[model samples]
Target chain A: MAPKSKEKPKAPTPQPPPAIEDLFASLHRNIDKSDYEKAVKDADQVLSIAPNDEDAIRCKVVALIKDDKIDDALSVIQSSRNLPIDLGFQKAYCLYRQNKLEEASACLRGRERDPETLLLEAQILYRQGNAAACADVYQKLQKSGIETAEVNLVASLVSAGKSSQVQKALEAW
Target chain B: FPPAFQSIPRNPIVLDLAYNCITFPDIENRMKKTRKGLISRFWG
Candidate 1:
């Protein structure tokens, strides 16, 4: 008589956290709709679970900016000392929003001359009403082939006398 | 605007708002004055 074969038990399937994805998706939707408070709440929930989550932190900052909480936004970025380059750019942007032209300029100056950083410098100049200087920076960036949507948009706004629009465009970027 | 206007202001509120906060009535007023001055001096 053949010995009866023992059946192996199947492993349990992992269940997804509906809350996490729902929160994240809600954050994105709020951002798209410019509902900053809701975005911040969702981002905060995500951050509580994953403190080092860059995307969540960024969303929080964006929410702050949209809500016109520039100081709070800058403080958040400044508190995060070891931020990545993109976040660094965002911090610089917060400075620009606050009208700290020199500090904002310094932030970009300390970093490598990438398209994004150069755009930030140009934006500071534009906001300071240095149209010629802003144009010069844009020209240089364009010559370097580092033109992004942000750079182009700032250039347009500078020409149109809507320099503050740069912040809005950058946030969207 | 002009290069002269690019000079940074000495006001603490202006400086702090420029480098720290999001929106300020003073900054907006200053920006309006600067823009108007720039327009009149250069564009006009």
Candidate 2:
């Protein structure tokens, strides 16, 4: 019988790489906990595994935005194309934050009727000093059953120097 | 809405609302406070 030799323990099979879902879950957990930096790192890990993962890209951009890294967020946004999800609203929001009102407005060209898009557009209009246009956009949102639009609508009217018509506008609305 | 963004509301806090009144951190004051905290952390 062969002398029992100390056999080198079999190298542990390399642990399978973490599931993408698991990584995304951790990323979302970090986001929920408001640990945006960690969330960004987690998102980067996910992106490393699946470079075109739309959800991962969105999470990273959102994490950067939350972290006040708007320039970085915009860079990621501008670099990606053919994204599975539309990030126009997010792009417009970043532009709006940067005070690029015209560029922000351009982003909403086809999405003007989306409630959130309309709200952002109205805000851009307000910033552009086109209070009348802002008020008009808000009125359209109000007509679309967006209750939050009412206050903004009144504010826009006031901004447009139509404070006296507040009551009339409310009644008509 | 982003937490960094604050809407400037007129008077009663509803009308004349200004979207995204972006405020910058007072970096000089912040740096002083950070330095004081670090010094205290190590030397206190």
Candidate 3:
């Protein structure tokens, strides 16, 4: 008998392309509703498709933070590839929650002029018992022409418990 | 603003940065919901 014909190896099955946009939108919807479980699920779905998806990773990190999973959030941030600027801010936030004000400040200081980082810097300064420095950061952020609720929120923190500063911040706002 | 933010006009900014822009404030709201009373000292 002729030698058995060589068997052809089966081709790998092709998977459908990741539905990135839909997953991202769903993640955003969950985040908006504070449905952190759904947000995480969606983010994980995106990550499963493209492990290096910075947005999805960041979303997962944010969902973790919102869900009060600080350590997990930080670990995710530390492990994410091509780390997004927002992840640094997110890490700082986790540090802040852990009451590591100085470390959080250091983390914020290492980032460039991310508006979010600047706001967190101010918050961290306030937590570190330097409202003056916090106020300074807030003023600098305002001077930079970026405005948002978090900026205003940090500005409020800078003035909290000080009537004069509160009055000034109120006037500025 | 980095070279990235500088190059993009406000009207034409992409969704990701805008999303990041929203994240911080969203965080405050989330904290209020999650941590409730503890957020008072910070926000006061």
Candidate 4:
């Protein structure tokens, strides 16, 4: 008969939390799976090590928005080390999504020159039923000599000024 | 909606509903602002 081994079996070691790169990979995986709350937690872990990381911060905001925690998202940016004003687009978006049209409209008030802010403002104005104002934003974007699919679409909506067209265009995007 | 997302009342095939909790059944409910903003920022 063979002798039994005297060595005891080793227990599995507890693994540390994933490295930042692995955490980001997990973040995208969670997002792809539409487990947004889990994605938020992953983003939080990423932010814990790199508090001012733009990608991590943006990921957190996006996950919060996806998880329908728009208010918490706004607070997340506000409480971050980054300046809240720098995230006007995100704040405006949260308000816009929450149907606080007036607040959304006001959030991008001073950023009219920024192309991103211009597009977001145009959308907010359109939702507020201020087509003329929305058209003005499109025109300004055109005059700025910046061109893109979004600008072209915004221009088309400006020309049509139809609510149904606006809805369709926004939806198609 | 969260409750509906969590679990349906009096549903037998509860396991089938498990997928709904982690997946977006409504595209319209996806955060357009964040999605669009992120894409625009990426390509803009």
Top DockQ: which candidate number?
2
Clashing pairs in 3: none
Candidate 4, B4-38: lDDT as tens digits: 54553331110111112222222222222334566
Instruction: Supply DockQ values for each candidate.
Output: 0.02, 0.06, 0.03, 0.02
Worst 10 residues of 2 chain B by lDDT: B22-31
Which candidate achieves the best lDDT against the true structure?
A: 2
Residue A39 error, candidate 2, Å: 1.6
> What digit string (tens of lDDT, one per residue) describes model 1 on residues A1-173?
99888664545655765456566767766777878888788878877887777777777876787798878888878776775625566678877777787877877776887666766776677677676676566656544544253455555555656667667656655
lDDT of 3 at B15: 16
Query: What is the per-residue lDDT of model 4 for residues A1-173, given as tens digits with 9 covering 90 to 100?
Result: 89988764555665886667667777777888989888888879877887776677777877787787989988986887454335667777778777798998888777745666776676667667676676566656554444343444454454444434655654544
Q: Alpha carbon lDDT of residue B27, candidate 4?
A: 24
- The residue-level lDDT of candidate 1 at B26 comes to 18
B1-44 per-residue lDDT for model 1 (tens digits) = 45565575232111122222222111122112334465456754
| Better candidate by lDDT, 1 or 2 | 2
Tens-digit lDDT track for model 2 on A5-109? 986575576568765766776776687798989988887987888998777788788778778898998988888856666777778888988999899889879
For A1-173, candidate 3 gives per-residue lDDT tens digits of 99999865655665676457666666767878999988989889988988886667777887887787889888897887355445667777788888898887787775786666776776666667676676666666665565454344444453554435555554575
Question: What DockQ results for candidate 2?
Answer: 0.06
Off by over 4 Å in 4: A1-14, A81-85, A112-114, A139-173, B1-44
Alpha carbon deviation, residue B33, candidate 3 (Å): 34
For each candidate in turn, the interface RMSD (Å) is 16.0, 12.9, 14.1, 17.4
DockQ of 4: 0.02
Candidate 2 lDDT over residue span B1-44, tens digit each = 45686787573223322223121112122112323466457755
